[model samples]
Target: MASFKKYRVDGGKFSLASIDPADSPFLEGDEQAQRDRLEQLAGELDDLQNLLHAEGRRKVLLVLQGMDTSGKDGTIRWVFSRTSPLGVRVTAFKAPNDDERARDYLWRCHANVPRSGEIMVWNRSHYEDVLVPWVEGWIDKAELRRRYAQIQDFERLLAETGTVVVKCMLHISKKVQRERLQARIDEPAKRWKFQRSDLDVRKKWAAYQHAYEQALAATSSRHAPWHVIPADSKRHRNLMIAQLLVKTLRGMELAVPPADPSLDGLVVV
Candidate 1:
């Protein structure tokens, strides 16, 4: 097994170009084998999630960020396929609505955080505030820096309060994204997933990549570290993320509550 540390971003030293989206360091065998491994990992995840709910004492927040076609939704679907919905909640962040815009950027995110003993996945997250605004030239460097600090602080607060934050940046190449976007246009059923605005974002792909690189580097910390997952192969991406979550949850040492001595002599009717 490859150590996830290899993919983790060091403080203020991340380079998006350093990792290849097509790289599958954690993968083994052909496509079928990868899929089988993913299924196995998914089963482990389900068990771990049950233990998480049983323990009823810690929160988990998974933040997913990526370029268009980076498979953030697919990651959640396959990785958590066996876990009960009661244990996992997903929140996909779209553009800020008028109500959202009125508050500080992290306000909406704060409201959706996981409660004790639950896992919350953010499909797109507060990082978007830093990415879109800077890439579109809405905010300058100083403002971007401030937002980064705010995010770090917010995540630290979550950590101090018993939330374990695990962030992943789904890494994919421009060529792969183009192929995915084109496939969405070609496939009738997938056409709804394709948006005209996605093309607009594609035009600024380089800018978005730079923005992500900056945000990732600036915000990755001991409490809320970011992992870069190579995502060109959907199977490999699912396998990697599943393994990551399984490993992280296992480390939490989750277990069912201790039996009460007073109930030892009692029998159910």
Candidate 2:
């Protein structure tokens, strides 16, 4: 039960003064027990999703942000695989297209925000405008500061409009990331997963960490807090995410809407 702390950027390094995922007590549990709980949580989350969709009163937005090969894909696969696809939408944001670049940075993101009665999972999100661009030095210091404020405002607006935002940052150590990257290179089917750019980014790992630190600090708020889930163990990561999702949705007090009385006596039978 380690407490969560906001991260800050300083001299190209993430400064998390008093937080570390390795200190999480949940990881001390037995592996099999954790997996069992994960399955249970997933079931409850599926139920909650159905209730939310039927109610048609509120929306849920789950934002997953992580480094390349940090298991964003795997998290989606294992944790959300059983949820009803009809009410769930997953959007993976890659580099901006020409049209996206032409408008405001938040334009593409705002357009994809989930409507009431739906659940939208952002693979990567508008945070990228502050994250990647800032780390890569594509934007100046002043611009980065302005974008951070704008992001906070954007999320506040979403919360005000009945969209519950749950942001999770999948955290993996440099050593674990290297092992995963090497495994991808060693396996034939996974070889395509590795790219030269990954190595280039790895070289600037400190810079990326700093960028993430700044992004998390600037965006974490009462309406939307970031959950830094330790991701060195895929099973643990998946379990934590499933548990968090179930808890958040269940706490929202979702209930099925009443059926139409006019249709009650019109059955085909």
Candidate 3:
């Protein structure tokens, strides 16, 4: 199996320039073989999730951060296709409403933390608080620095409390994003998904990229490392995330509780 180490953001010198958005490092064999492998991984993930639920003591939190048209929804759809909804949950963070603005930025995210034995996936997470504010100049350097520290502390709290945080930044190319946005505009069935605001954000792509780079670097840690997935190729994005997830759950060595000795001689009527 291909290792995901190369994709990890190891603090200091890590940057997106080293990764090619179209590269398919995890791809193997031919097209059919790749598809088969993805299905296999999805099934493995389901089985692992069942073990996690049965264990009923620890949890997994997957945080997916990316720019527009970066396949956050697509990743969730395909990766969890075989997993039961009973044990998996998703939270999509949007622009702050008045209620959200009333609290500190992490308030909403802290509320949505996964319970024991559940797998909670964040489509866009608290990182947005920092990214959007910093990019739009709503906050300054001191605030940005403080938020980064607060995020790291927040994740550390989760880690110390038995939640494993898995963060991934879906690194899609600008060209690929343009193609996807155009598809939304041109395809009649997809027109409703298209928003003029998406174009407005697209105009500030470089600023967002810089924001992402800063956020990922500042928050990434041993407790919650960020992996950059080359997402120009959708197959690569799905495969890498699925593989990484299965690997993470497996590493946890989850298991159900031991049977009670009192039941040894008992049989159901």
Q: Write the per-residue lDDT of candidate 2 for residues 1-269, one digit (tens) a residue.
A: 32233321222344553445343444546877777767777778888899998889889999999888889999998898778788889999999999999999899899999988999999999988988888787899999989988988999999999999999988887788899999999999999888978888888887887788777877778788887787778887887788778878988998877787889779686
TM-score for model 3? 0.98
User: Using TM-score as the measure, which candidate wins?
Assistant: 3
- The top-ranked prediction according to lDDT is 3
Query: Model-by-model lDDT, in order?
Result: 0.92, 0.81, 0.94
> Per-residue lDDT tens digits of candidate 3, residues 66-181?
99899999999999999999999999999989999899999999999999999999999999988888988999999999999999999999999999999999999999999999
RMSD of each: 1.1, 3.3, 0.8
In candidate 1, stretches whose alpha carbon ends up further than 4 angstroms from where it belongs are none
How close is every model to the real structure, measured as TM-score?
0.97, 0.90, 0.98
Which stretches of model 3 miss by more than 4 angstroms?
none
Task: Provide backbone clash counts, one per model.
Answer: 0, 0, 0
TM-score, structure 2 vs. true = 0.90
